[model samples]
Target: MQLANYLFFTTGCEQALAFYAACGLGEVTELKRYGRDGQPPTAAMEGKVMHARFEGPGVLFYASDNHDAEPMRGSAHILMLEDRGETARLFGQLAEGGTVTTPLGIQPWGDYYGKLTDRFGVQWMLNCRL
Candidate 1:
């Protein structure tokens, strides 16, 4: 399975998207607004992104706006895996003797995904498109 990076923007995703696009990271391949999901954003998150994906020759970046999120610090990267089998295997290995914040399972977003803090104290996110 191939690996990709995912990002989360507690706020200011629009500006971040613009900045990265201008920096030539890649084109904005897909964008989904919160309201488009039939779940309108609150006043603070109005016009903000529910999800945005950027793609380049060897890069994939995903981001979303979180209006009520706590101040983000450090890296919030998700290690995205493309194959379900590999994702499950690696997630099992990583969760061994570690904390599983979210059990591996199918999510409404059309993927099998999970979150954990590995034994080495590193956070991880494993994903496989369904």
Candidate 2:
């Protein structure tokens, strides 16, 4: 069995994937739009991507536009907290048995930033934009 991340976007899957490629994440190997799905397209689905495969240096995932549903949450996490104490607390909790890739502290970018992988292998990123 193979495991892959699938992302659902309400719209602009193409543009989002383009941005990802620009960020050196990955490039879309194949893109299929709703209008060309061998099914009649509705006005709302005309320019939306039905499915797309993206592959890059270390990432392989699929993305699609689902006009009626909210976007799916992926393994990556970004937490923006305003409370220093709370931030530290959560950081400690997430760091329990997992590896802390980046220590939680004020970064050169002038924000409290850190990254960690939970015991379950999920990655998390925290940023307290000061």
Candidate 3:
């Protein structure tokens, strides 16, 4: 299992993905439009990313667009691990007593990843290589 850390901008997820891809980070493995799945997203979320993943070095970063769902405010961001099995274990453990923002699964970027907030309100990011 491998782990990495990252800070994703809350808004402008798509723009950020493109910028990172252009900066030689790695590649935008997945970029799904919010309203493309037949269940169209709200008009305000048309261009927003339902899910996005970017790879750099041995790291995979995940981000999502902020619709009118909720406001996320904090200064913490980290891409935890890059190992699938280990990440799964950690995600399960952390979510056991906390809240999971994103369940561990194959992300749009072709990697296994998830997000959650620990019982202490600290956010975490888990990612594993595809």
Candidate with better lDDT, 1 vs 2: 2
TM-score of model number 2: 0.57
Per-residue alpha-carbon lDDT of candidate 2 for residues 1-130, written as tens digits (9 for 90 to 100): 7667777777767776776565445699998888787656778988688989999754688888886755333567566777777678777777677789899999999999899875544566878878
Sort all candidates by lDDT, best to worst. 2, 1, 3
Residue-level lDDT tens digits of model 1 in 9-112: 66667666665555444678888887676668887777778888888754587777886554344544465767788778777776766789889999989789
Candidate 2 lDDT trough over 10 residues, lowest sum: 69-78
Best by TM-score: 2
> How would you encode candidate 3's per-residue C-alpha lDDT over 19-94 as one tens digit per residue?
5455344787877776784447777877667777778775577776765434345643455565677677767765
Q: Which stretches of candidate 2 lie over 4 Å from their true place?
A: 74-130
Residue runs of model 1 more than 4 Å from their true location after superposition: 70-130
lDDT of each: 0.70, 0.75, 0.65
True lDDT of residue 50, candidate 2: 90
How high is the lDDT of residue 66 in model 2? 81
Give the range of the ten consecutive residues with the poorest summed lDDT in model 3.
Answer: 2-11
Candidate 3 ranges with C-alpha deviation above 4 Å: 1-11, 68-130
Q: What would the TM-score be for candidate 1 when compared with the true structure?
A: 0.51
RMSD of 1: 12.0
